[model samples]
Target: MHYVTSKTLLSSNNGMNLYRGCTHGCIYCDSRSECYNMNHDFEDIEVKQNSAELLKKELLKRPKSMVGTGSMTDPYIPIEKNLKYVRKSLEMIYRYGFGFTCITKSDLVLRDLDLLEKINERSKAVVQMTLTTADDDLCSILEPNVCVTSRRVEVLKTLSEAGIPTVVWLCPILPYINDSHENINGILDFCIESGVHGIICFGMGLTLREGNREYFYKKLDENFPGLREKYVEKFGDSYTVSSPNNRELMKIFKKRTDEKGILNDNDEIFRYLHNFPQDSVQTKLI
Candidate 1:
């Protein structure tokens, strides 16, 4: 809910975060990790006042690459309905003839479908959505302020039908909470039906660090009472709080994704996401 003038926009790797903090009340958000060093409250979103202009500058100077956003914060937060920073950036990216991709959990992305379709037509545009759980009730608990799982699946399918490829981040699977076979299978079924181009799942567990770990534990105590003690006993001070069923869950994940021919390899998917497609009609830079 605050604004600051930023000097730069895109990263050396062609990624940009239009906002610094997030409003999405995800209980397992790793962006709150102490490693990031945010100066404001997590919910007090910090908007880059000059994002569109800065992005246009960056896009004009750099060679064509897949520009990405929403790494540290979701670009489609409710404020986006008014701020339109993400939409403006997409306009610049499309106008500059750069491929675009973003990771988000909001259906508000549908608002910019026109620009996304245009970018994909000129170069490439991939929309990546995160689906943590298939159960809408659990999704409300885990990623509380965003669209539910079913709605995100609808968004994915909508993007697919629009000829825009999509990727899904199936991650942060909490142990004892959402690590069962039924949960993983349900999420995987949703992905398969949505025709997602790739799925990036590091493992069947979530990471916990100094800042995020405490916040996650606090939420756990509030929601799943006494779960904090269980975590302390199981993964005292570990960063990667992996699920006990990581092996078995990963087995199901790999089998389902592989059978559906969806991209499951992280490196391969990153390559697909990062490597700017040099297709005949899409290579001309503005």
Candidate 2:
């Protein structure tokens, strides 16, 4: 890990990434795509040493609080063990009473449960987990080296029981791999059973780009030989890799989410994510 002084920490939308590049090694990671243009290796994490301090400054100046992270890269990367930057940032957010949200695949987030609960008590805290496959074996192949789907479900359940809302990203359902009807239904079942507030699934598919595509194909050749050629023949340098059963799987996804009353539309879920609720006392006065 290397430290760099960031000029600014939060984005216009109030998102912040304390670290760049990930070590979790998800085979289909989009952050590794050339479009992102990281100067360092993907595993050689770049830490924003000033992130927490800058976040404190920014939150102090803001009129309202709605800060989020873990969009471009997972905030709770393995390197966080030595850094503890994410934990410190969460402490700042809780101290300032800012609503917090993050997307991560690691159960390491449980370590900061105290700060998360505090933020949820004062404002709101949303935890979004990405679940691509229900099968542990397939999950190992697809998102190798991260926490398995079952453990992530446990995290979601634990967060839900704490009254901290949760969202699930059921995405990148690799074509011909984990795109079966049973796989989608199994994950959706877990979400509904765990009482997830919403699910963000953009159809049933994955997208491959310059850097990520090469990496994914290399993994395919190593693990699932002959699959790379099939992908090339089917997609042929295309960005989107929709499953052949996309329509059918989406039908099940929409119907099940609709039945459970979980927020299914991406825009609506995003709105829920960004919309900070006014304090109950303020609402009563108004």
TM-score of each: 0.97, 0.96
Tens-place lDDT per residue, model 1, 8-62, is 9888898899888888899999999989999899999998898877887778798
Count residue pairs with overlapping backbones in model 2. Answer: 0
Candidate 2 C-alpha lDDT tens digits along 14-125 = 9898999888878898989999889999888898988877987888888566789958899888888778888898888777667889999999989888889988887888
Off by over 4 Å in 1: 280-286
How many clashing residue pairs appear in each of the predictions shown? 0, 0
Worst lDDT run of 10 residues, candidate 2, spans 277-286
Q: Mind sharing the TM-score for model 2?
A: 0.96
Residue pairs clashing in model 1 are none
**CA lDDT, candidate 1, residue 193:** 89
Superposed Cα deviation of residue 279, candidate 2 (Å): 1.3
